[model samples]
Target: MERMRIAVAGASGLIGSALVRSLTSDGHEVRRLVRHEPRSADEVRWDPEKGRLDPAGLAGCEVVVNLAGAGVGDRRWTDEYKRRIHDSRVHGTAALATALASLDPAPRVFVNGSAMGLYGETGDRIVDEDSPAGTGFLPELCVEWEAAAAPARDAGVRTVLTRTGLVVARGGGAWGKLFPLFSAGLGGRMGDGRQYWSYIALHDEVAAIRHLIDRDDLSGPFNLTAPEPLTNREITAAMGRVLHRPTLFPVPAPVLRTVLGEMAGDVLGSARVVPRRLLESGFVFAFPGIEDAIRAA
Candidate 1:
């Protein structure tokens, strides 16, 4: 890819921050869309919640990536927090898409963030990018989230929706919370442990995003997950093997329900999602299996 101007929303986040670093390291001119007042030449100001964004801020950028959203696992699923999760992604994405559409020579690509939760509980059924969305709160949220990018797509800009899975990483994310507990021998399966968990290493997640940005023919939703999906029990075993700890503890479904409330269903639910489109696009995974992803983290 040639050196180009790129703008990224949510540039301070786990994947976003890493992407900015990767693009900058390659000598791309990276502009960060910040909510606060611009503090430097590289920072542009925008407030997605309030539907605030200046089209000029993203002018001349060949590509724009939107990853801003409230963390789903950040807090217990209170009604208010759930609203934040939905609005943050839907509204923020709409704002960015509209701004991109307004550009005179709109960006060549718009890569927006989504999640695998769109499939809901697959109960061991293999799902891919073309699978119909399952019924549930998470699934409905994802539908709206991806639809929010219509402005950019409708304006003739190539738009790519990345339905990312659980990112295996040492940094912040659901997987980040697992290392300490598993290393301390306190980690265990969330429920029956039969539920499938589709995951990709943080390295592959970032690389896949870059791959989408570089491909002119790729658009629509692509599952950003590894080719293989493993069950929670298998993942727990991998964690124990990787950390050289005993996997003796097991948390029951009732216990998880009491602790995590509504979010517990997501923890225990199964979705055997795969990256059919990503692989077809020729994006390779650095950590393609459970054990490999665990070791990478």
Candidate 2:
């Protein structure tokens, strides 16, 4: 394996932390761009909201991965919160791309974090990187989110936008928020629960990212999901089965619409996305099945 110098923004977050661990443990030089003064050698300081980063700190880094963003489900989707979500991603991305473009020794690869929401609610359609981007708030966000990375791309960086799926892990993301409710027997299918849930185990999620980073031929929007896409009802039932609990509680569509508003579409709609490129690139999944993922998580 080629040892390289890497820098990751949002290293405190779940996926970012996992990537940092994986990169550093593999004998690569990994540095984290943090919001506060870094306490270690492998850390740099940057404030995305203020559009500030240490250009000098980024020197000699060959790979830069931007994972900074406002959490989508962290709060109710008020207009202000929505704007915050959009601005956070756009501004952070713009700042990084601009910084990288100005560098004399620029990073060769820039992995930009996007979401499967870029495809909107495609029902049963299996969209890939070449598919036309859909319309809707999320799709719009992704469109702009990706546009913000143009500066780096124009600077000759090999840019990759990971249109990621629901990442199931131990502490956070979709599974973390849902696990407690399911374990307490309060979990159930929301709405019709027929929408496809294109989810990936966190292990594969991180591994595929590392794979993309190492592969120079891979670029553009890559759907980072599993081979199998399960429905909401299926995921709920699987969780119950894993814990030997019953999942029968139901959240009506009306209630979801009222609570999540525009987000209701994402919460209830489907994105049966497939990683066409990952399979083509010969990457293997560590936990391909949700049952194995839930049990192991």
lDDT of 2: 0.88
Query: Candidate 2, after superposition: displacement of residue 41 in Å?
Result: 3.7
Which stretches of candidate 1 lie above 4 Å from their native place?
Answer: none
Write one digit per residue (lDDT tens) for candidate 1, span 37-74.
89999999988776688999999999999999889888
CA-lDDT, candidates in order: 0.91, 0.88
Give one digit per residue, the lDDT tens place, for model 2 in 1-297: 789999998787878988989888999998888888779988888777667876888999999999999888777888999988998899889989999998987898999999998888889887887788789888999999999999999999999999889998867887888989988999999899999999988888889999999899988888899889999999988999998889989899999899878788888898888989889989998888989878768
Candidate 2 lDDT trough over 10 residues, lowest sum: 46-55
Give the C-alpha lDDT of model 1: 0.91
Clashing pairs in 1: none
TM-score of 2: 0.96
